[model samples]
Target: MENKIAFIRQHGIRVRIHALLVDRYLQTYYDKLGWFSDPYEVFRDIVNDPDKHYIFKSILAKTNVSKFDLPNKEAYQDFFGVNPVSSFKQLSSHCSWTGGCLLEKLERAISYDLPGLLSSVSKAAATPAPAKAAPSPPPPLPGTCEGPGCEEKPKNRWRKQ
Candidate 1:
């Protein structure tokens, strides 16, 4: 259990770092092209084409990084051994690509203090709802008597004899 927790933390850190690196790389390329509309889509287009894959691979290689270095790469391989890159490839296949889905997958791969979130959620769920204060008795109506079993009476207006 402890080992799993440690791996999760490490995975989160690596994924975050990788995200920053990918964003920086994409931004730089986008800047060079004078294109600024949507960088992730550009990145997706680059990744999806075999011709462009070389450029993408060059960019990655220049950074001295590998897909294998990414967190959960093994899990990706284990789960989708036939096409480990398919997970990333799908990012481009979609009509609208934001890179958010990729980030989410990475986030989920790592626990990201999930235990803390769960504990806080559990504490909130376990807490009693302050008993609702019993809805307090309604305020007495005007001209009403102020004793138990009392009812409203008309105000006396005549002068006392």
Candidate 2:
């Protein structure tokens, strides 16, 4: 899976530098906050961050980044005979590409304490909801005669009375 993700990182229009940086930062942050044992686990938690939001925006816009980031794009090209290099080059050269912006923010955000945010989020998520009290047992039926001196009675009848 890492290999596949790495391949996507290489060819996808959305540069992964920012996502990777954020992921690394969030992990350390989560760990320091006592939310996670290591920095690696922040991938699942920080996936909803701005990096992913940028990817979603690209996908919604049907931009070059979205086209390039399709899962198994290489296989798709092999089956369809479409070249990816031309599109990749165009996207790389685009003046206002979101990928470029994402990369820039990732660089800027690197110095900031992103882990603190992630740690707070992780702590909130880790907190379990309060358990509901168990239901009370039902009361005994009236006139059941459960005392020690009472004789056992047959269902719906009294014996030889």
Candidate 3:
């Protein structure tokens, strides 16, 4: 964990809101900012995308995304990949905001049936952990031998005059 933290820090990554799940669309929300190298790049793509103009908008509209609450690159792809230039609400009639937990919510949002972007995450989670073995006893310390047959330092006898 320390190494991972150090690596992230050394690489100039920041934990930003990657995506806002269920904020507008059921499949719309994401982890809401994660460790990102250039978080604004994500924001720029979304706000600038000609397709995303309706879900996101000018000062006159209520937007589903924010600078801090933006989706990762995958969600953007999937959103557009599924249906570009069309509202996500038309995707389905399911309206359960609180169906799954955070992880499940993320899985649902990103883990597509096809080998899409988040397939790695689902694959990892599905993989079973290796079994653990029992720990062995510690070794004995030095200079503390007291059993029989164990040698002790030689003792000198008194010299005769």
User: Which pairs of residues collide in candidate 3?
Assistant: 16-33, 17-32, 17-33, 18-32, 18-33, 18-70, 19-32, 20-29, 21-29
lDDT of 3 at 42: 47
Estimate the TM-score of every prediction.
0.29, 0.24, 0.20
Q: Model 3: residues >4 Å from true position, as ranges?
A: 1-48, 51-54, 57-66, 72-79, 82-92, 96-161
Candidate 3 lDDT tens digits, 133-155? 96896776776776788777666
Sliding window of 10 residues with minimal summed lDDT for model 1: 83-92
Backbone clashes, each candidate: 0, 0, 9
Scanning candidate 3 in windows of ten residues, the lowest lDDT window is 13-22
lDDT of 2 by residue, 1-161 (tens): 44443444354333443243333333334444454454334333333342443534444363223433444423422422343221222222333654555444543343333444455657777898898998997886897776689868566565555
Candidate ranking (lDDT, best to worst) = 1, 2, 3
Error of 3 at 8 (Å): 19
Q: How much does candidate 1 score in TM-score?
A: 0.29
Tell me the TM-score of model 2. Answer: 0.24
lDDT tens digits by residue: candidate 1, 50-158:
2333443543565544566543433422433353232342222423355556555555555445656555667777888876556878997787679778755667779
